[model samples]
Target: MTRPRLLINFAITADGKTSTVRKDPAHFTSKADLHRLLEIRKRADAILVGRGTLEADEMSLTIPAEHEPAKQPLRCVVSRGGSFDPGHKIFRSKGGAVHLLATDPRPDYDPAVYEKSGATVHTGALPDFLHRLRTEYVVETLLCEGGGSLVRALADLDAIDEINLTFAGHTLFGGQDAPTITGALGEHLPRSLEFELVRFDPQDNGECFLTYERKR
Candidate 1:
């Protein structure tokens, strides 16, 4: 059996902030990074994102026309409360499959609505959900495009195998409150996690595309 691999792709500022001072959180990546990001998504078996990311970005989560939409990866969303917007474009696509995971016992959602729109709903523990993806769906490569909270949760669980981080050379200093990529690493990471740098490409916007493989 092929071991499941969880790969996280995100961008941060030079100061390690994933967002800017505006607190809106969209200025972390450059155009070049965006292109590479799409390319990576095209190669994966499945793509996963947190609910907050889905709501905030309103992402279509589809591969562009240059790639075959039918060949695109399965899109999955993790929401504890099953609070995803049914009208989102990602759900509108009938060509690809969509899966929604919620922890709520009686989720306040209409499963038929999403099913009609071409999405499947599942409920279970997060780890078990991922395992099912690997075993049932044959998802060997899982890509995580996220809001910080989801990324942190996955990191805490040690489920991630690799991280593709792009650092934009801009600073978003001084905010009332903002989230960082690493927030308060406690005893869970005592000796500090180690990674091997894989790629570094400089963009016109002074952003650096960096990739790292986690040391097991």
Candidate 2:
């Protein structure tokens, strides 16, 4: 049960959609939300994302110099298959060590390929990988910037501690295929996980920032 304090940061449209039906990059929020995101990210020892989200966002996964963070957080990605592109921006970016967790074992994928690129590849269940992050990497705070499916997995494991969200009321991506914070309109989580709203900050730009702490 020992693991890092898991945190999720997501921006949702008025219709509660995280992305377009095509699963586009989440750029609907304002500059303030972007600033808020980096502020939240600064406190994490590591940042995690599903491969789809990572690629969609084209994230460099590094704090900007202007943010003045003490050091960059480790960049981590999870995928069912270990098929990451070597030319991905994350690999070329200068930041903390990269760690990839391929939850599903595949015979054709070679971990050595990524190792040669300086990324540590891990295989196993999400819970085990998270536990390893805490014990081996000493990650006190683990931030998950989502694509939803990954969030659902964490929720199923009851591993989430804090949820940070920005409600962008000005935009709406209403489509049956559009994804929500948990994922595409689908089955419920294993069980209801209760949370207490700890922070509610409404902005003048038709947006609201909210933070919830897991009630446990």
lDDT of each: 0.75, 0.93
Task: Output the lDDT of residue 180, model 2.
Answer: 93
Please give the RMSD of candidate 1 to the true structure. Answer: 2.8
Clashes of each: 0, 0
What TM-score do all the candidates reach, one by one?
Answer: 0.87, 0.98
Q: Model 1: per-residue lDDT, tens digit, 1-216?
A: 233698888787666766543446464566777888888887688999888777777776778887555477888999887877877878766434899998673545767777787688898878888888999999989998876777777776778788888887765443534555643223354346678898877777778888889988
- Residue-wise lDDT of candidate 2 within 84-173, one digit each (tens)? 887898887899999999988578988887888899999998999999999999999999999799998899899999999999999999
Cα shift from native, residue 52, model 2 (Å): 0.3
What is residue 30's positional error in candidate 1, in angstroms?
2.2
lDDT of 1 at 16: 72
Off by over 4 Å in 1: 1-3, 20-28, 67-70, 105-107, 171-176, 182-191
By TM-score, the best candidate is 2
